[model samples]
Target: MKPKASPKTDQSTVRQRIVDMAARLFHQQGYNQTGINQLIEEAGVAKASLYQHFKTKDDVLQAYLAQVSQDWFRQVERAIAPLDTPKEKVLALFDLLKSFLESVDFRGCNFQNALVELPPAELNTRQLIRGHKTKMSQVITDLLADADPDLAAQISLLFEGALITSQLYHSVEPVNAARRIVERLL
Candidate 1:
């Protein structure tokens, strides 16, 4: 006879589905506006199932932040991997960012948008955003160490400026401009 599936296995699968759906919704619709009911409906999970995964809506938001953080970092690592030199690796990040900017579905950077939209009460989400940004900056600093140690700070600043400008201008030029600056710095 086939072994029976445990409730824990079903519960874990439902929880992951919820988190994945929540991440998609939060990215598309902002956190403050998305409701738990809508999330369950989208995830195709019951309220009890959601609660089995997350105690509160805040817990789901925390999970979303953590998920996005990991996803973004993995993308960054993959984007930077093709190039050999540290400078190339660092500049490749801007290339990765440009691809995002040019994406038709791009609304903006979910992390920065979350920082502005989520309430001060959402400390876990805020911390996750902060941690991701710090790690990104550290990666830049590390890559720039061999080339122009002094340029690491500028690179991070330029990266952030480009991110904001790309969203603000709704164009890919800011990424190009940042790339040009990075090229000059190298």
Candidate 2:
């Protein structure tokens, strides 16, 4: 006999639970360090259910990255919404990064972390990372529409460097320095 299907809401809940647990685990520990069994236990879902929702752990990682991308963009939009002028908004981006670093205890960029942890063979995950970064660069580009086109690229590099440096130092000093450089650039 075939097994009965779960309700739609239950299935959605299970999937979200798994993704949420995976996000936390993958962030707190590197992706490879987290095990499928731990995800099942922490998510409070059956092993079969996890496989039902995600054919592989990589699928779960993809979902986590997607969710993070959406959340990150939303936060950025909200952070810059109240500012006036492109320069102010662009500078505010660094402030937002500083807040984020402190909030996460200087864990650094999730996309960067995933890129470092995931093998190049994981093309889908790498593409997601690239897409998120491209979108972020576009945001800066749009904000600097009146300025030299190349400034956006320079600022993007500075932003990424600051994140990595902040993570290394376990402090927001790098973010502050990046903000100073951005101020000069603007």
Candidate 3:
């Protein structure tokens, strides 16, 4: 018989399962509303097991944000990688948002959602959220090098506004509007 798998492998699977379950719950519900007890219950892990992996509830939330950020970055980069031009890449960003809105799991932007209840002094999570936005804005900045210096900032606002507006109206109209404006700016 083949050698048995190490216990570490199984433990990692449990950790990943917990993170995955927490991610879904946190998105479907609100971060402020998610509790550690609920996460343990839904994740099907004992309190001791959760503590062994995550020091605290905040740690679990941070871990969820970290994982989602990685996935989101990869998704956007992949979606724009084969585009014909930077303009196409920029527009493709809108397309990405469109798909996100159309998804059955559509929740407001995770980074933005995480910051909702945070006090002004919450720098770690704020920095994490800012980093995601900055990278996204850099894509716009790279694509619009010849435009106004503030164009990226403007587009960034429009980009964020689209997410909030879409959430407000429960429609993708705002993303389309932002795309039109971006097209004009480009």
At residue 50, candidate 2 shows an lDDT of 99
Q: Model 3: per-residue lDDT, tens digit, 30-139?
A: 77788888999999988888999988777777788889888887988899899877678888999898898778344778888888867798787788888888888887
lDDT: which candidate is best? 2
Mark the 10 consecutive residues where model 1 has the least summed lDDT.
Answer: 101-110
Each prediction's Cα lDDT score?
0.85, 0.93, 0.84
Q: After superposition, how far is residue 87 of candidate 3 from its true place, in Å?
A: 1.0
Cα lDDT tens digits, model 2, 1-186, are: 977777997899999999999999999997999999999999999999999999999999999999999999999999889999999999989999999999999888989999999877889999999999999999999999999999999999999999999999999999899899999989
In candidate 2, list every pair of residues with a backbone clash: none
Residue runs of model 2 more than 4 Å from their true location after superposition? 1-6
**Candidate 2 vs. true structure, TM-score:** 0.95
Top candidate on TM-score is 2
- In the range 78-108, model 1's lDDT, one tens digit per residue, is 9888789987898789988989867735467
What lDDT score is found at residue 29 in candidate 1? Answer: 86
Worst 10 residues of 3 by lDDT: 101-110
Count of steric clashes across candidates, in order: 0, 0, 0
